[model samples]
Structures are given as C-alpha cells and as structure tokens.
Target: MAYRSQIRGEFIRRYSECKAAYLETSWRMIHERDVKHRALNTEFGYPEPDGSFGIGCKSSVDQEYKRRYDEIESRFRKPYDDQLPALHRWALENSMSVYECLLMDDIWDDDLKALAKLSTMEEDWQFQPIIAKARFMVARWKEEHVVGEIQRRVKIESSHFHYAAARCRNLLGLKPWDLAAQKAIFDYGKEWKSALEFAFGSLTAA
Candidate 1:
C-alpha cells in the first residue's frame, strides 16, 4: 500500500517535479509485482492483466484510471457532458463484466471510484479509505499470483543441477516434485500457498 500510495500520491509530482525520486523507486517495486503476477494468470480462470501493478488490478481500477487519463487528455481536448454518461455507462458495463470480473465486481468498483473521487477532491490530503483500498488490492493480488507463478516456474526450470541458492531464491516457486499434487494441496490455500512458495522456493520431492 505504501508503494501504491507513493505511486498515486506522487502522480502530479511525478509529472511536474524534476527531482521526484518517489515515483522512480515505486516503479522499481512495481516491476517486482509484474514478475510475481504471472502466478495468478491461470488461477482466476484467465491470464493476468497486462501492465504494472497499477493496471494489474480489476478492470474497474483500470476504468477509473482510464477516466483519470481521459480527464488528463481533456486538459487539451475536453468533451461535452452529453457524451460523458454514455461513455461512463459503457465503461462501467464493460469495466468488469461478471463474465470476466470478480463475484463482487460492483462492490469493488464502488469502493475504487469513491476512493478516487475522494482523493481528487482532497488532493491526497484526506487519505484514509483511499489507503485502505490501496492496501487491500496490492496484498490480495500479490497473494494470488505467488502460487501460480511457482507452479509454472518449477515445471519449466526445476532440475537436480546445483544453481546458486541465493540467485535461485527468487525462483522459490520453482519446487521440485509432482507439480500437480503440490498444486492440489496448495489449491485449497490459494494465496496462502502462494506466500509459502514465495518464501520457500522450488518445492522438491526429495
């Protein structure tokens, strides 16, 4: 959440400040999330969303940011209100369809939009619920991707050959064993299994 807040909070500074180091550092962390996001690709019945941690979350967040982006663009090309509702409705409808989105898609969308509105109105000063959603999304997404990435990693790279323990540490998900069986037990745990694999690395049968 700290990282996320840094990214969003520093948005204006990111664009205007010549010496903004927070955005740079925060981006580095987001790259790590990109690597780990591979794990959650198949778990949710679809692949991971393309883009950084900011874009890796639900589509509502994407749409919310899309609106922000549009508003930014409107600084040069503002559109009339007549078309706003239609566009918003279209985005809301496709933002995260039940056919593709979570079970609580509406709830999540509401929370995200409310937070975005609050942040914009408060200009990053009044930040309570905004921080909460930020934390929730990052922690939840990271937890999910860990297990999936590990299972995929182990199958493609697992070997008896000795690799540097430290270098191999990042690939902890690359366990050595029946990936199916390991996944079966881990399946029930979802994010928990992901956390374990992330911590343990390459599950081995031996």
Candidate 2:
C-alpha cells in the first residue's frame, strides 16, 4: 500500500508539472501571437490615413486628411488588444483545449499536422513556422480567388469585338483592310462578344 501511495503521489506531481508547463506555454503563445499581429499591422501601415498601408486614395498634402488618417490609424493599430483577452476567456468558458480552439478557429491545416502532433508531446514547441506557412497559404488563396476573380471581371467588361479583331489582325500581320483580317475579325468579334457576355452574366450571378 505504501508503494502504491508513492507511485500515485509521483503521478500527481508529474501531472501538476505538466499542467503548469502547458499553461505557461499557452500564455507565451498568446503573447507571441499579439506581437506578430502588431508587427504585421506596423509593416502594412495599417490604419493609415488613406487605408491600411496607405492603400486609401487620400492626398498627403491635405492637412485635414492627414489628421483624420492619423487618428484612425491610432485607433485601429491595436485592434486585437481587447479581442485577445476575450478569446482566452471564451476558450476557458468552453473548456476547450488549445489545439481544439486552434482547429475550431481554422488556424491549423494539413501542412501543420506534423507540428500539431509534436505540440501534443512538447508544450514548449514553437509553431511559428507553421503559423507563417498558414499566412502564406491565406495570401495565395486571396490572390488566386479574390484577385483573380476581379481581374477576370475587368477583362470581360473592358473587352470589345473590335479589340478582338484588332488583336487577330496584328497576330496575322495583316492590314486593317485585308479580306482575311476582316473575315477573321467579323467571325471572332461575334463569337468573342457572345462568349464574353455569357461569361460576364455567369460571373455576376456567381
């Protein structure tokens, strides 16, 4: 019985140690995430007068604009400060594990599967690389879907039958008055315009 008690006490001690380590690591992770968020905002000039990273069209010479921009930027630069603490509280209330919370938040992906496995074993393991990779994936996703869709719409809206004909004539090294160029232009213009119109409607509906 004494031996069993000693073993049980040892188990309890180890469990306490693991819990403490996990909590410390989680707090550190939260801090690191906040630091990273601030760094990204700074790098992008987020909350700038024009827009994040000065993406807005406001002129720099306008004193009023600059003043408003400065005020807005200051307000938005620490956008996540309040939310981070709330997130921690929510996780605690829900009795969610860190990994479970991360998965629920859609922060982890298949690429981090290995890191996730390691995370279960080692509380102090840094997942910065995985987080960086996830950020890159999000950027690529935006480029492929959001930016690509916008570009496609712009092309369809700006293109005309005449432009297609002109392009064909140029490619064939034919003058504007050439019979072949005129025929190609006529056929291509009709086909291209119809196709583009259909695509435009479909994209608009989507």
TM-score for all predictions? 0.18, 0.23
Clash totals in order = 8, 4
Instruction: Mark the 10 consecutive residues where model 1 has the least summed lDDT.
Output: 97-106
Give the best candidate by TM-score: 2
Q: After superposition, how far is residue 116 of candidate 1 from its true place, in Å?
A: 1.2
Question: What's model 2's lDDT at 188?
Answer: 39
**Candidate 2, after superposition: displacement of residue 160 in Å?**
4.8
| Highest-lDDT candidate | 2
Q: For model 2, what is the C-alpha lDDT against the true structure?
A: 0.43
For residue 159, give model 1's deviation from the true position in Å.
31
Give the residue spans of candidate 1 off by over 4 A: 1-5, 9-107, 129-131, 134-206
TM-score of 2: 0.23
lDDT score for residue 19 of model 2? 41
